[model samples]
Target: MEKIKRIEPFHLRKDREYEPFLQFILKILKEIDPIFHFENTVVSEDRIDKPYVSLKTIKKIGTTNQGIEIIIEELYEQVAYDIAIERIIVRPYGLNVDLKIEIESTRDTTDQPYLELRLIGDEIVNNYILKLFTQQFQQIPLDNEKLKRELLILNTMIKRRQWYTVETRAKAILDNFPEHPQALLALAIARAAQGDLEKGEFYLSKVLEYQPENCDALYNLGVIYEQRAEYQKAMRLLQKSLVLKPKNHVVLWKLGQVKEAIGEIRDALNAYQEAMKTTPNPESKIFTSTDFRKEAKEAIQRLMK
Candidate 1:
């Protein structure tokens, strides 16, 4: 039997062009599963007179190459747009909108041209390869060797700050095993790291659905709510997390920050002091506990004054 070739994982580089990076993602997906095909579904344009115009006139937005050209044309002001083009892969079904890559293009020729690419999906891909694994290994145990290897790859990618690959690989496992809590948590962390807080919150919520007592999910979700300035919700989740994991210095630090945000100075100070005194847990999956303790010390000193 021919061994399946493992593709080297890739992350978005700072110096790379948007179009090329988009093309690279498509190429990687195709390589992962040759059966999977990409089709251009939606092309939104920004006109001088009008705000956002759907390119209804131009037909044949078929292949991936043509889709990319349309985006470039819209960006450079050669086709129609004046301000920017928004939205891509908006189709709901039939074409697997699982990896929706939306490119918000700018028509500016100034330094630091703004081109924001948003990845909107269920947090991962490469479904075909995962499908093969599922077929070959039926009723695999929770601590199965294959699953362990996949999770090990995820952990390595997380340590290397390869968030994009982490999201993709975790997503592949989820495609086959939706109830896998570890993959869900990994995908949540990956999404949040990449600045998709909405997706992050969604996946974390899913994790809690399976394991309500998950300290990591509770604490991370609390942090997300705090970032969004929802102090009450943050407080509730953080408190629950503390009940499960009293020694999590990061959670204590975050709790302090949330309290400080809502003008509860005394509680915040006490929380920070507690965090500084707690031994930093090296097994923290999402945050560096030592950094949290350092921040907690600074916070305590500031609040005392």
Candidate 2:
């Protein structure tokens, strides 16, 4: 693997000159190394635009002095109405050269509209370094530490919210660490809140694959199944969770609901009574017993017939 020496950040203006600037950069990269491939790219000029766009490229290379390989993975873009900007991070593995280039070009009147670049690594010959000295001397400092801090702040903001925040942060985390079960569960909760029940179930199942015996996952899966009227599956999962946490009044209450839905009135009544007994407060007592007791009492009175 080639060592990355410098990573540059560029900001492009959203004005009418954006397309030409992008083309110019593309031309420059292709001229330097015809095998160069962009990692992420996006273009948008409308408000009702999708947040993501996918791009695929097939490059044809002629006979070169040395063998070179280029692989681009996960190229995407997020575009806004006034700002059609994209970021591309390239990893050149076999290159033994380090160089930095910053191109700032804009036709806008504002001073903030400029492209920034930093030459990362140099495997090029010393002669090339001397030739590129002027451009290298003008390189801007890359604040990667500051950027990391900003990303952490953004992720924290997502975790503190209800639906949008959780899903966004969960995805951001998963992008970096796909196998994190807690992040999957957080995404499931967010999707459930957003009424995306199918996606929520998928995420919950993923969490269960990592932690099959997780009581919270089992209980929540049971609730989702019950909502979808899958009585048998709901009952089995709720019961399994109850076996793990017998004193959980909420699970007992859910078991009662499932049993009642399945026409097992006596079993439902028993479950409800157990739930009421485990509940900690008077408010919970009313909540667990009011309807179950009424139904049980009515059944008993009819049995006297």
Candidate 3:
């Protein structure tokens, strides 16, 4: 038997159009199999346009009359408002398949959400099931119970500053629904805060997989790289994120830090000045009177000397 490696979920950046794409995929997957349980489901804003659910799961067939339990590992990169489904399926005992499903929804606007379903191998039947599952899911209303439970766990971890526990809980959620973008993001943040920059990068990468234009994920990635002394990579990612949210003070501040680390004193000073310009009044409290600011000012003054 070939070793089964766990597949990672798609990265949906905070500022990308991921939800509509996710929804389109979920609708199709639901149509494929309603009984298939998904884990690590994440929902968040995608490009300020719509909310999307990113999900992942291990699919299994109940013991049949022949007593054979068929298990298939699958992953999806999709959106909520979009009707496109891009999936990869691996069945050890059978032919492996990769498919893209495109569906056009006539019930809405002329730019109907098109669904893209692909069959890479013998998984065409499974694709059909995805179509059926989507139909059924549409009839059901949104259920926030699962989300509430996950959020509660996250809140507890945050309040206690149990960063490790937060990551563990988030991972457990992903174990069941690996495509959950919010869980991925939260886990990334928790990991970074816990000083596990590598793991955080892994999670942040997942966010980028789905939402290429996610400014938050990019910024976070830049921070992680900067911490690791990967100055050039950090600069590139931070610059990209800044392009999307030019007024983001946090990004500016971090860019300053990266520049300072790389000995670009002038650039660093400019970045800090820019950060101060856009920083909100309430937020300024966090950095205004601290030793950190004192050190920063002293460093800038020394740069002049």
Q: Candidates 1 and 2: which is better by TM-score?
A: 1
- Model 2: residues with Cα > 4 Å off, grouped in runs: 1-161, 279-305
The global C-alpha lDDT for each of the candidates, from Candidate 1 onward, is 0.62, 0.52, 0.54
Candidate 2 lowest-lDDT run of ten: 1-10
Model 3, 1-305: lDDT tens digits are 11111112212111113335344445544544454333432322122123354233333332221111111112222432342232323221111133333322111111112223233323555545455534533322214686667766665665466654566556656756677776787788887876678879999999999889888789889989988889999999999988987877777778888988898989998877777666432332122222234444555676667
Candidate 2, residues 1-305, lDDT tens digits: the string is: 12222212112122223233344444445556566554432321123234455332222122233222221222233432222233232222222233333333322211222333334444453234334433542334325574465345444543454444445445555655677676777777666755667988998899899998766677778888999999999999989888887777777778888888898878887777776666533332112222344444454344335
Evaluate residue 301 in candidate 1 and report its C-alpha lDDT on the 0 to 100 scale.
Answer: 87
Q: How accurate is candidate 1 locally (lDDT)?
A: 0.62
For residue 212, model 2's alpha carbon misses the true position, in angstroms, by 0.9
Models 1 onward score TM values of: 0.54, 0.43, 0.45
The order of the candidates by TM-score, greatest first, is 1, 3, 2
Positional deviation of 213 in candidate 1, in angstroms? 0.6
Better of 1 and 3 by TM-score: 1
Best by lDDT: 1
lDDT of 1 by residue, 1-305 (tens): 11222212211212223444345445544654355565655444433432344332222234543343233333323444432332222111223434543333232222222333344444334344334423432333334677788887877777677765677668657756787888899888887876679999999999999999999899878878888999999999999999999978888888999999999999999899888888667776655423676788788889888
User: Which residues of candidate 3, in runs, are more than 4 Å off?
Assistant: 1-142, 152-160, 280-299
RMSD of 3: 16.7
